[model samples]
Target: MDRKTELKEKRKKIVAGLEETYQKLVEYKRYKKSPLIIAKNGEVLEIAPEEILPTTPYITNS
Candidate 1:
């Protein structure tokens, strides 16, 4: 197989297992004491004790 096809197949296989992983992360983020949870490019980031502002008021006033 070509290198591009090999990489695509590898990515597909990696993505196939992510559903369960994301489910577990959602549950953990809900229960854990963190305000932000981000997953990107194979990295997981957690921001603790952050503030969540109401965006609707800010958006409508502009």
Candidate 2:
């Protein structure tokens, strides 16, 4: 593989790993009934675990 293709593959792996980690974090928060703290529009907000939507349809590897 060329350098560019190798870099792209590495980036994809990194993104997939990050996404999986995020899902695990969301699951942990839900299990503990904890709030998810996030920043939106320069404001910090605490979202309930029940209100957390954990998945995005951006990367489909299959």
Candidate 3:
């Protein structure tokens, strides 16, 4: 295959791998009462018993 085709294929593979890894992250879930802190200057994420990882991100492009 041509270099251009090879580059495209590599890009596709990388995107797929990233997508797969992103999906597997543990923070994608509904939190009934997860602890958090409101800050005056900046937002604060209170530490949970465990890091809140879910199946997906809070928002997704597609």
Instruction: Specify the highest-lDDT model's number.
Output: 2
Output the lDDT of residue 6, model 3. 93
Better of 2 and 3 by lDDT: 2
Q: Best TM-score goes to which candidate?
A: 2
Write model 1 residue lDDT over 3-50, tens digit each, in one string: 989987887666656655655555565576556666878999765633
Model 3 lDDT tens row, 1-62: 99989987897777777767755443332234453333655866564525544433333343
Task: Please identify which of the two predictions, 1 or 3, would achieve the higher lDDT against the true structure.
Answer: 1
Q: How well does candidate 1 score on lDDT at residue 31?
A: 70
Tens digit of per-residue lDDT, candidate 2, span 1-62: 99989988998888888889889999999999999999999999999999998964455553
TM-scores of all predicted structures: 0.37, 0.86, 0.44
Stretches > 4 Å off in candidate 3: 26-62
Q: How many clashes in each candidate?
A: 0, 0, 8
Off by over 4 Å in 1: 31-35, 38-62
User: Could you tell me the TM-score of candidate 3?
Assistant: 0.44
